[model samples]
Target: MDTFTELFGTSPLIWAILGAEAAFWILLFGGLAVRYLLRNRRLSTIMLIGVPVVDLLLLTFTAVDLAGGVEPNFSHLIATIYLGFTIAFGHSLITKTDAWFAHRFADGPAPAKKPKSGPAYVRAAWLEWRRVALAVGIAVVGLLAMQVMVGWAVPSSFAEANEDVIWSMALRLLLIAGIWLVAGPVYATVFKSTPATDTTQRVSPASDTLSNHR
Candidate 1:
């Protein structure tokens, strides 16, 4: 117990967040397994419902830790990011996973392939970037709320540590948002023009041959 506390520090919220993350995946796959393999929709619904409950549990843990005046650490930042991304993207993930499970276990249709290139790909990329933006926004809001709760004072070592941790987290989030924007939207926009160049090159040979014959 002493070692465990030492490893995670005095706050149990870190451990709780870890457990919640593990529980989320377990419940997701377990629910799908029960639904498709065992053909038990009722039980599966119960298990799948438990997935969001796990998120709530993590939120509660974070809130309690902060309320108790625990110093903000990496774990708190992680909790905020995790919650943000999960809230923003969890449903899509669950739907995609369920489709795969259905195909594998229940003889359902195969999942549709994601677009790889062209306008479709660009649109998908933009859509994904929007989701990334939403997630980042949520995370920023969460960090701000935490700061508000803890106040802006640095009268003590804990307050200074908290400020440092929060600043690092904010910077990390900004880096992520910027990278996603460039990689997803900017790259996709550039890639969308490549097909036009390739098509023009392919047609240039035919145009030269026709002119020579004339």
Candidate 2:
């Protein structure tokens, strides 16, 4: 296709991706603003629903296009990146936004919940890993799906002439495997090792008794 044709043809896809990206950031910040600034749980909860709706629409369009053999475009990659950021930084983003909003207008201090440990910590870590794994897994699946679709849809000579570097990696399977198995436990262990405060340190029983007496 000509440059103009390709660009014009992909415009709808681009807009869809942009809409999804907008939905994510808007719902994130908008929901926090409602919860902290407006102090409206009902409204905030309703706004929060938009996040998944956007993701659902994005995924539906992606699957439809791929299943129908549309060649992958840059917008698809942007959507993937958007989803990645949302999954990875979502909680932090919401918490920080809430804290900032509350600091300014909620007339109360931000809630500072301590990190969990033992079973709760393990469960939270597992859930986080699953979220990250799903994001990474989606990228991998999308890559593979594109490869299959392109092979099916495009002429072999045409695809060979315009092969993309993004799909050229042979070690993607290894990368996906590492993301699934290695990334989670390593991150959890490192996170646990780092304390939130440097002023606190463990002391022996004698030192504790002396300090208490003093």
Candidate 3:
């Protein structure tokens, strides 16, 4: 234990953050593989939840270290909450990116496409914008919750390290929202031109009757 502590002694908190980062990717890919490949949603949920549990371990350690009068790095707190956001919101980002790629290049049906022009184009743009808005809203809520947890855990140390943490987080959130908002319009443009194979036009009864008469 002495050697172990010595190795991480200089930056125990950074080590914790590194551990959480590793946990995040492992949980994401592993959970996705189990969820889709094995088709075991229950197990997948467990794996996904386990991602944040890694941070919980770090939190436990940090709290203990603090109690022992050891100074902890503030980045450890940020990394904890950062991983929480990844656990909470990463799936949505992944799903959306997958969908966008599929629509762009896949041979199957184009799900997001609409009529090329006129009111249909406008409507599709509006709907796409709304979807982006919803994602932004979910992300904002996740960040707020994360901030609250950080606020509770390392109120003094975080402030000492960076008094503008709240503003930093806010600006980060805004940058995320901005990216999505810009992507919304690009997605809107892509959806406006429906693929020929994707179109589903119903024949009118009158046309059928006329054709039969002929």
Q: Which candidate has the top score in lDDT? A: 1
Per-residue lDDT over 147-175 for candidate 3, one digit per residue giving the tens place of the 0 to 100 score: 45445433355445345554455456567
lDDT of 1 by residue, 73-180 (tens): 767888999998888888888999999998998889999988667787788888888888888998988988888888864335644543577865776787899999
What is each predicted model's overall lDDT from 0 to 1? Answer: 0.83, 0.65, 0.59
Ranking by TM-score: 1, 2, 3
Candidate 2, residue 107: how far the Cα is off, in Å: 3.7
TM-scores, all models, native as reference: 0.80, 0.56, 0.42
Superior by TM-score: candidate 1 or candidate 3: 1
Q: What is the lDDT of residue 105 in candidate 1?
A: 81
Ranking by lDDT: 1, 2, 3
Stretches of candidate 3 above 4 Å error?
Answer: 1-9, 72-74, 77-214
